[model samples]
Target: MKSILFYLPTVGSHDQVLKGMSGVNRQNYRNMLWQLTEQARAADELGYWGLSFTEHHFHVEGFEVSNNPIMLGLYLAMQTKEIRVGQMANVLPFHNPLRLAEDLAMLDHMTRGRTFVGIARGFQKRWAEIMGQPFGVGGTLSDAGANDRRNRALFEEHWEILKKAWTTETFSHSGAQWTIPPKGLEFPYDAVRSFGRGLDENGVVQEVGIAPKPYQHPHPPVFQPFSFSEDTFRFCAREGVVPILMNTDDRIVSRLMDLYREEAAAAGHGELRRGERIGVMKDVLVARDADEAHHWAARGGGFVFENWFGPMGFTESLRRVGETGPIGADYRTLVERGLEWVGTPDDINRKIEKLVTQHDPEYLLQCQYSGLIPHDVQMRSLELWATEIAPNWL
Candidate 1:
């Protein structure tokens, strides 16, 4: 079934919005939580399949106000029944694998197996600065590649550990980065043959295991969100990770699918399976009439595009170690890029149809709440889309 997922952003307007790509504001966080809960409850009633939260550390433009996606997921699970809850992603490098395992396990149980985990290597530099760390800044992928390689390795490594922790009776590991202490003398920490799967030095095998066995029988579905990089796509296909394409252009999505399927075929995997979802994130606002949508967007969406996507598209600049610039300096450039799109239900539907036909995505995620948008207008947009647009698309 084609599903709709919503990206909930809970931050107001900001001056240094680009500095922390996904940072959450404290006051805004409280306000958004209530708004988000009401929205999710509505989505459940409306038969939407899932809702997702993005992870961000420090961005001035109000990308993500709340830093804790897992906590949010659990809260949603407790509040709702049918709708699935998840993180659009958690940057693997910024996590402690063991704690992640615990959180995922507890959440899966609480949600009764409605948790989807999207993992990625993050791209924001201002967040790095907040942590007193350094990265190749200003769109420089100098060490990003190496960092990605390490992050991927560690991410997969921890995935194994978490899997082991869930299924095995008393799992023990002595890998390069992790070692689970032995439980006791009576139990040798020998997980069952069907505990879980992991990679050894050689090739793929099903004999290995991870513990506290996932309540979902095998495991919860794991996806890696990517931006259509050939290397990244190939890696995802090879590693049995689902490809969750984000902000991928129409042409790029087609090329990626072909390449991904070809590689999977060459690997003797027959046809690519299970990795069918592609995520298109757009700044969307829907209204009963075009003018209202346009006006609301002109006010709210303009700021979102200018503050959020503007810096990234043009000059992805960040001070090195310790540098400074006027606040909102990049906002004008972002506004110039023309990233915001606002329209009435009909116009919005036309654009969506074009995108859907071009990309043929199995899912479309609407980033409806963005950039300090007013609560009433945002709700109207959601309701209109749910009532007018969604049924037609389905």
Candidate 2:
């Protein structure tokens, strides 16, 4: 299985209690960046397949402070050679499609075609509200019965435009959410002829294409960060994008994979490729003994539940996605449901083997840092995972 190191670039000292949406200290922020760079380099040296970063905004609690994962990817890319760098997801609604296209193309070029793209419609209502997007899932935030379809529509529209921008020499778009080449406005087709040149027979000006095509042919591999909806699974299968499974039971994951394979076959993509088609993310904590591992897991998981999920209203978000079991459950319940793997090296190894055998995922992404887990403890877990567990899969 391919192993990936997933990072949130959390910015707060280990001793600092998570009080929910707290402010960030500049020194801590700098230190976090440096440490993340160091850890990423270590992962690269240790034969990791990729290093993925999360993107979040306006979280003062430092739960997830990597606001610009593309920038972080670039930073890590400069320091490493072998490991692929990517975003766990770039929230679609929060960005300008043209700018994102340009940035992604640039990143692919900068990384020598080692950049990957993950797309999401986003989940946090606060992020949408702050960005002046239509908050909520199905409709505007003010709409009481809103669901996620509206945001999904926006995400689809933006994604279509981005793909066009990347592939077409000159493109124009007229869609529900965006209008490219501005209506009723025109520019000179030829750069040299500034005054008057290259107008259409109807005196209409042509749209200019975005420059610097991506280093990868057509584009880099696109990923869907979390797969929960059947529509999303079909979309990924049809478009050749991989879906990353997150915080779901093994049965659900298997079902989703089966659906994806069926869709791909229907779409004439042929047999699904192994070791490159699907990814699974799990929270992992490895210690010398089960007691130490469980201790830290409980503390970290509680912090994630109370501060991260509770404050961010992610429990409700999960409900919207039809994941109801672990919404309000305690950390132990979550562990039992396979959302977390916490124990000694042998214990984690056994759990990993079972997951791999059952799901047949191509990539295994470990979320090793979260909540109030100290930097030292997190590093130790990484060290143990890389040394003791990762080799078995290889």
Candidate 3:
């Protein structure tokens, strides 16, 4: 299976705070950046497919503070030669469509076409509240029926505008949520109005599009990160966007892939091939022995389960899906349920092979680093994965 490293640049001290420590050490953000860059270089040299980053804001716990993944993507692009750099998702509602489109196009050019775009309707309520937009709409975990519908509609409108901006030379949009070059404005009404000169002689707004289109013809590959909604699956299939599955079981993934294939055929996109458009992410840890692997995986997994998912209300969601037996449990339980992989290289390879035979995923994203795992330990796990497990797939 093709492999990608899921990078979340969390400050080590944040874990201490989560554990109720009286005081926490302050970490230099620059050092974290340097470490991540180094890791990206290693992944590149090791022949990993790509590195995917997450986005968050106002997260004091530093669970994932990558507010601007495009900026990080640019840095990684410059530091590496071949591996693709991408965001697991750029929260769609949190950004201006035109600005996001332009930035992604620039990243594609800067990376020499080694850019991947993954879009999502953001989940964090605080972010939407800060931006004066409604949160928890459509497919969000906290969604309440109608409000969720409205939020999803807004996301769709914004996405439509972004796609048009990238693919069309001169496009005009009049959607419910936005109007480009907004109507009913005189040419010289405002100083900023004259900047783009996007107006006709009759004072009507004119069509506009991004300059320096993109390095990839049409655009770079677009991916939709995992969501439970069939609508998302159908949309990805229809648009030829790969779907990245995470935290879900193989049965669910297999069902979703079947749905995606059926939708693709219905949409005249032809039959979906095995291992072509699907990707899966799993928490992976490799060590000298099973005991060492379990110890570290338990620490990291428990921390993530409590600190990250607990506050976000995702633990209950997983319980509803039968992925977890209870909150605040031991990681061994999770491991037994196939939610995580922690063992020797042979053990990991066996589990991964089972997944590959069952799901036929095009890519397997290894989530090796998270919550309190020492940098050196994480690196060692990665090394083992590269030297021992990766060759089997090849």
Candidate 4:
């Protein structure tokens, strides 16, 4: 099975997509919401399997909206019936995990069990400063190694506690940043009760009882979004976490998938299957013709570089958050490189065919977000891909 995912861009705000487009004023902001909702509805109809949105803080980057992603997920859930609603990731480190967990649980129920969660240790210094956390000073003691270690440790500790909260009964946890009360809290009514034993009179259960049991058993799937990390790959395979690779080089994606397959076999895990967890992402724009595609992407992609890539310093933040060091190029260069695919249906199909043949990833994430592309243009791209491009593969 080939997994296909769709992203809703951040065009509501004038930061990225609306940079050069005329008529994108305040009223259009409200219009963008309705526009996205309809696009999502179309996705559900067109056989798209997953819908994802990116998360960010502040308005500096054009890729993010002032509205919370969880709220957007809920809205998408109401509009569509089958498509899996996802946050290509919601930043885990920036949020209170418990609140994040609760909101996700509610979203799962709201969507009739079509919720997927993506997590990342955040990498923005300015955002961290806004939150009053220490920003990693450049060329100081807090280099990439130190920062990665801190973030990795925090993620491990948080996961250990969170899984317990979600999958166990009456557990108590004590950590540097969090302390759970004894006697345990009541599970939400919707929470699944996971236990080897039976239930008691007071509707209370033992062994393991999670509040608001998720509609899906063993919890709705957990996804980790990043690129090219050996440790992350090993950990994901061991723990059954899906890894979402983004802005990744083609050769690296092939190598990583091979590595994952080898490790899974070496560890006595069953034959690794595609669409099971490993997925690669691509930046895309499709249009009626190659000229139109190039024109729009060049304009929109530049804004993304200026607002999000240039200012937010993705390269620096990812390095600090334990991603592999320095991105190795300028924002404009990277954006131009990614725009290698902005073309008409035939050109896109051929390029994607090569990627599919070469990498054979479980899934492909189309970049509809990440820059400031207008809602109409974004929707047109989605339509063209779904109607013209995707069907070839299907």
Candidate 5:
């Protein structure tokens, strides 16, 4: 299985984050970038498939501080060699499709076909709502809410435009959310006559093209950060976008995989094999022993889930089988649910082996906390995972 390091990108320690400090501190930001670069460099040398960070904003709370993943990815891309760098996603509704299209195309060119893109519907109301105002979208977490529909509308439209920008020579878009070249706007279409293609018979500013088209022919590969819905699965199946499974529940994940395969075949992707073009993400922490693993997990991944994901209602994926009330309410539930693995290297290997045998996923995103988990501990986990566990799958 190919592996991607899904970094949380927090900007400080668990103590600093709990105190609502360090995220906005200039020095911390600087140090975070350098330290992240080192991590990327190491992952590259260690034979990782890719490394991704989330696109978050307004994190004065010292958690989820990755602001613009394209920029952050560009910086990291310049610093590392083999391992691809990109966002687990940039929230689609928050961006202008043209600008995002151009930025990503440039990134693909710079990375020399080493970049990948992830798209999200966005669930954070704090920044997502404010940023999505232009597109008439609101933040949502459910699959069928009004906000969810709006976000998906814009999400699909933006991706359509991005692909067009990369694959089509010159394209014009007239969509519900945006119109290319805008309406009633005059251009230099007639001024220079040297411009290769710009106007139609009616001279209506026919189309606009993004410069520095992607280095990869069709485009850089695309991914969906998380998936749990039928609509999302079908959409990914049709669009050829790989959806990373978010939940570890056997019933849930297995059912979703079956749905994806059926939909892919129905969508003319042919009889896709089990575990083809799919991914699974899990929170993992490997240490010298079970005690050491739990110690760091409690201070890092578990801390974030308890203090942040729990109240934010982002922990449903970790809900225990046939159990309810306060999902992922504590660290113990997190471990019990198998949502995050914290154990010795041998224990981790066993769990990973079981996971692979059960799921057979092509991509495995091993999530290791950053910022809150000390750099040394994170590196050790990476080393152990790459050395002991990764080879089994490879």
Candidate 6:
């Protein structure tokens, strides 16, 4: 079980960001950058496999202020030595896939192969809807309505364009949502056209190629964020993209794991080892004792689930066994769920061991930097994870 540190990237704690008080100011953002750098440095030295951040925006209330994870990833790469720097997800429907391809290729050069990619379909309404309006789609929340259908169509289309821009030397696309080198457009650069492809003898645009390629062969490792949909599962298996499973129910995860392997075999990835190419993302708030862990959870991880993800309909995995409806009524509820390990270091280890021993996943991604946990508390938990919990698994 290789561990990856995940930063929800909330700028401040509940005390500093409750209600109308938000930390969108330059000074608060500066402090956030500093703290995040320190966290990245710690993870690098702690023998952790990788570190990641979420991609979010419009958090004026200072909850999950991860506006641009790729930019954050580049900065983290400069600060850390070994740990891989990447986003847990960059929403696909909200981006121009061509520009995204160029930025990532440039990042691969800058990071010297320390870069990875995590993709997701947009889920936030505020930014996702506005950003996607030009592209004829909007954010979705699993409602499975027309909005979801449109979002999925555009997301898949953008994904195809991204791959074409990266792997193909010169590619042309005529998809439902996009077309590279618009048919009527003409580029009559004589020096360029005289040299190679992209323009025809009539000086009409034919195809396009992204520059610099990538530091890693074809491209960096690609992963998709929390996948519950069967189509996403099959897509990941087919494309060899690892889907970080947020479904903590082993019954569901176990079945998905089997289904993933079955799909992989059909996709020509034959006979994988148990849990190969699989990842699980779990919430965690560890401390020396139950009381301290409970304290940490309320102000930090619990605040995130209740205030942020809860409204976004993402706290489903944190529900108690045999219970339904709204969750994270209190810290104890988060602790009771299969999705998180919020307790003493020993307690977390007990729960973690149960999962890994049964599933044996290749990657164990934890939400280490959620909400407004105090820096000291986060550091102590980091130490506990490095010294007490991780060694048992690694």
Order the candidate numbers by TM-score, best to worst.
5, 6, 3, 2, 4, 1
lDDT of 6 by residue, 1-394 (tens): 8788888776665666875546576666777888888877887888888888888878888877888889989998998888888788889888899999999999888999988898999788898878887988888886789999888888888889988988988989998878788897787898767676788888888998999788888899888888876788888998889888887667778878888999999999888877889898877777888787777767777777776777787776554347665555455566666666777888988887788778988888888754477777877788888899899888
Per-residue lDDT for 1-394 in model 2, tens only? 8877777656765456444333377776777777887777777877788888877778777777888999999998999988899988888866788999999999999999999998887767676667734423322321223355567677788889889988987788889877776666655355424543435555465565677889998999888876666778888888888888774655567678888888898999898854348888777788898888887877775456655655544343234235555466467656766767888899988998887777778887777564356666777787888899989887
Show the lowest summed lDDT stretch of 10 residues, model 6. Answer: 320-329
Candidate 5: segments with Cα more than 4 A from true spot: 188-195, 201-203, 320-325
TM-score of 6: 0.95
As for lDDT, the candidate ahead, 2 or 5, is 5
Model 6 CA lDDT for position 352:
79
Q: After superposition, how far is residue 11 of candidate 4 from its true place, in Å?
A: 4.8
Model 4 weakest lDDT span, ten residues long: 134-143
Ranking of all predicted structures according to lDDT, beginning with the best and ending with the worst: 5, 6, 2, 3, 4, 1
Q: Write the per-residue lDDT of candidate 3 for residues 266-340, one digit (tens) a residue.
A: 999888786578787777888978898877776675556555655675443234344445454346546655667
Cα lDDT tens digits for candidate 4, 193-302:
34333234344433343467566665788777764477777767776677776544555566667777777767778888643568766667888777877667756654
Which candidate ranks first by lDDT, i.e. highest? Answer: 5
Best by TM-score: 5
Q: lDDT for model 2, please.
A: 0.74
Instruction: Report every candidate's CA lDDT.
Output: 0.60, 0.74, 0.73, 0.63, 0.83, 0.81
Runs of candidate 2 with Cα error greater than 4 angstroms are: 19-22, 134-147, 192-203, 273-276, 310-327
Writing each residue's lDDT as its tens digit, candidate 5 over 273-366 gives 7878899988888888789889898888788888877787767777546867766458888888887777888898888788878878888877
Which of the predicted structures, 1 or 4, would earn the higher lDDT when compared with the native? 4
Question: What are the C-alpha RMSDs, in order, of all predicted structures?
Answer: 7.4, 3.6, 3.6, 5.9, 1.7, 1.9
The positional error of residue 89 in candidate 1, measured at the CA in angstroms, is 0.9
